[model samples]
Target: MSIFEEEILMLIQCTPRAGAQWPDFDTISEKDSHALAAAFQRASPFPHLVMDHLFPSPMLQAMAKEFDTAAPSDWREYHSGLQRKRGTPPGGHLPPTVQDYFNVVYSGPFVRLLSRITGIDDLIPDPALYGGGMHEVDAGGSFEIHMDFATHPRTRLVNRLALITYFNETWTSEDGGALELWELEPPRCAATVVPHFGRTVIMEQSARAAHGHPQPIREGRQRRSTVAYFYTNGLAARDANDTLATTYVPHAGYSRRQKAELYLRRFAPPMIVKGLKAINKAARTRHTRGRGSKL
Candidate 1:
């Protein structure tokens, strides 16, 4: 590994449980390094964001060109999702394409470090678990605070974690779209980041991980990154005692009127929810069948 790569690897090899410790990547010994990986895997601790100069900068910048996001087809005058704003991807699709980068990241040494850190290597998230691979995100686009898609379509597995890598140059505090991680207690805004390069935020998939940005980008700024999601074996196959479910929690920053509307969407009757979903599926099927029946 290059010196840069080794340095970044050491930074990520430690536990976030110690808060964010920056290791002197050059001086660590072999035994100590082994312990770092061992400690990470044995504890099953919460994933922490890792920052290092090692996150291939030139590579990510070049990769950005491939993200060909389409116009917001789901755009609405009044947004009713995580935030009361818009200009975001409606599903797990990045504009141009980020499939290639994801393939390298997951199987690379990065995964090995993460496997040790999370101590759940057996259940590590694979690119195959994320439908269409990892979704890509960039500037002027923002996601409302919500749990991820919940499940990977093809794998039928409960998504467990999210790994985000921000690749931007000298991200300033003023950058409008800094990623915001809100506090679940008292429901307040907590951690917010400018999405700088070489910085990776890996967090548990839960209500506590409630995060999103709430502002529009400046004329020249861009938030570029690759996101990878992990999943457990299968929600049904997991040990009964190991059951874990992700809950959706909206940002407290929204007004009461907005929240009441959200509560209704979240806790409405199962039948109502099922009916709505069924209607959507029927509409999609009709659209597809209608298009083919023209033959």
Candidate 2:
């Protein structure tokens, strides 16, 4: 196990948000842990369980610093099919310390603790899904509410777990980049966790668990985070091997007019997309020849 995992095993336990106070989980006692877990058993902030502070404070701080310093990659320009980039692995080469930190945290105790808390302890993420690395989501960069890659290709396992660690130095509401969680019953928000420093959130991997960070950042500060997905080997869930949930193109982010356009595009025949691609390519070629460079 990695040292990061050792730190997590030494410091954390599961608890529900209802029974526990916010941002004060470090001091929550065992009694509160049980009560909170119970409260979430029937109903949680979302359809799934939400656990906080999966790693020790010191470890989290260390990881946060490393996460902030890792160079950002050029993944913004793509049909992420949603906001910003989809996901990017280690942006570039890292020093020994940074590499060691990722190795410890990504595959270490963080993953195990996640499994136990969710009662899917046997589950593991195909390293290929995340490449056993951290993912970065920046300011102006946001994601739609959707599930992750269904199964680990090599492992052929259904993804049943996922974890996120936010390292914002001083996240403020104006930052406009807090995670929004929605429940199906009311079909509305149940909780919005501010992306605070040393704050780690874990949740079950289910279609019902819809979540994403809406609105762009207003503050000058940037939003930073890392995520790891876990899976159960040889398991085929109903969603197994399906197109990533993000592909659905969540309509919640759209304005009224945007929503209509999206609906039209979503239900549009596949030939339309093919025709559009051809037209776009031809136009691009003409424009590029006119400018002597591709856009």
RMSD of each: 10.0, 9.1
Q: Each model's TM-score?
A: 0.61, 0.66
Q: Per-residue lDDT of 71-157 in model 1, one digit per residue for the tens?
A: 445222222333333223324444443554565456544555555555555555564433223333334544555544555555566
**Model 1, position 209: C-alpha lDDT score:** 54
* Residue 94, candidate 1: alpha-carbon lDDT: 42
In model 1, the runs with Cα more than 4 Å from the true position are: 1-46, 68-79, 83-97, 124-141, 234-247, 269-295
Q: For model 2, what is the error of residue 293's alpha carbon versus the real structure, in angstroms, after optimal superposition?
A: 14
Error (Å) of candidate 1 at residue 58 is 2.2
Q: Which pairs of residues collide in model 1? A: 40-116, 41-116, 41-119, 66-96, 67-96, 68-95, 68-96, 69-95
Quantify all predictions' global Cα lDDT against the true fold.
Answer: 0.51, 0.53
lDDT of 2 by residue, 33-129 (tens): 4554444444454434444455446655676676556554522222233455334442445534435545544554445534434545575544433
Residue 111 local lDDT, model 2: 50
Best by TM-score: 2
Show where candidate 2 strays beyond 4 Å.
1-53, 72-81, 90-102, 105-112, 129-132, 153-155, 234-241, 245-253, 256-295
